[model samples]
Target: MTPEQILPSPQRRQTYWHTALALAVLAAVVWLARRHWPMVETGAVRLAVADQGWLLVAGVATVATWPCSAFAQQGAVPDRLPPGRLVAAQFAASAANHVLPAGLGAGVVTLRFLMRCGIPFAGAATAIAVKGTAGGIVRGALIAMLVAVCPGVLLVPSLDARYLVAVCVAAVGALALLAGPLSDRCRRALTALRAYLGAVHARPVRAAALWGGSLAFVALHCVALVAVTRAVDLPLPPARVALLHLAASTVAALLPTPGGLGSLDVALALALTAAGAPAVAAASAVLGYRLLTVWLPLIPGLVVLGVLVRRGSL
Candidate 1:
């Protein structure tokens, strides 16, 4: 049988979508590199002048994301995963998340962790999907609230056609990539998503944990960026800084870039500069934000990942 005939409709659709998204993201990455290659050495002064106290606040918010992540992961399924292992899995998952594009690394790590906790493969995969859905919904709700409260936020940074296209590419890239983890058993995945999704929502504590944890996870990340902007004395208010981050991340989150690395940085910098921060200040804030959230935690998260693997907790 032909490949198309062998694969069912949903599976075939997913395959085609992943292929197209991968190509678009590859093009976007190359374009980003060509357009904005000079990033080092331009923003060091702003960092040097930043307030140390606000920087510490940013770091604290970044550190708190793992516990929120663990809570959300737990709420997605009925099985009670060990708390310490769950938190460590989340931290390590962050490291792995930055290594692979489109959240694949984190998804794989979570799947393994859940399975290691004695959940079946179908249950584990469904839980991951449930968590992702909750995260997306919470993010969208926050964006709506931020826009309502802070009108004129999310200024469209300079409106170049190239950038508009790049943003579109990133925005369309997430769902298909998110589905990749379950592509091997598409029908079972869908069935489980439906079955466990209802069960998960029907439980009061689970629903609360799922949504509440999702809120904290997204909100803390925004708080980290807001703190970084404050540290560098970026002129925008905290509300606007938080709103800009929400807008930029929503646009860039789906891109195939590892942790939305290049694409998100570009989006964030554009938004910050458009909001009247000088280019150097914007770059500095982005650097500090990444340093607090991604770079500093990466190695330790990886080490935790190794321990988890050695201990067979994953």
Candidate 2:
């Protein structure tokens, strides 16, 4: 082989190592967490999952979120890929998030899968970017509304000042991105984003649909959280539970720990305690939610990835 052909490209090597390191981290976290599984499972958990009715509702909610989330991502695409294939890609991506660190595995997998399906990397990236951006937007709006509408309910004295300051800083940053010279910068960013989407799909409506779908998908996730809490007979109000869910989920996404495994549990527990839920209940609720959502998706996603690779699609 030619010298150039024999050597791995730096970019490809970096991607390979990045994926390998991420997978290793995810596996280690999963192993450690499993060792503590018994501690996480208490009598309350049995009682919680025993509510077959609500558990079923939660399952449906989780499943429904997948497609909606996929659509939101699809919205960022300029045109639509085949719906069946797109859905499969989303499921596979879901699986990646379950097994990988910081939820990046799935995003990487999604980008690759779509690219193999003849989508441009730029468009696929844009679609993913839009989905992520939309999620941030949704969460920010929710947090702001909570602070405004239920100040007493959510405003802990210790956190309130920090929270407000953070919001102000974020607002200023957002404003800078949206106006004056920043407006041109914003357009450039969006234009780049659009280019990525175009690489996947050229149709605007399809991209919009995906974005909308992604939002609905996230909303379904929140519903699943509510359902899990109800199944456990937790007495937390729905709105309160939703807010906690949002906070924990966002934090989990930010965490470098695989699938936000440890971070997710801790975040949920803290959010619950902060909101005044009993410790045991908070832990159980978080555990139950992760069981249905995170752990459940990994195996299938890996399987799909294998299948796609075998089919020469990824």
Best by TM-score: 1
TM-score of model 2 (CA atoms): 0.75
Root-mean-square deviation of Cα positions for candidate 1 versus the true structure, in angstroms: 7.3
lDDT of each: 0.86, 0.72
Misplaced by over 4 Å in model 2 are: 1-39, 43-49, 156-191, 194-204
lDDT of 1 by residue, 166-230 (tens): 98888778657866885668877577677888898889898888999999999999999999988
Model 2 over residues 52-79: C-alpha lDDT tens digits? 7887898899888777866776676655
For model 2, what is the C-alpha lDDT against the true structure?
0.72
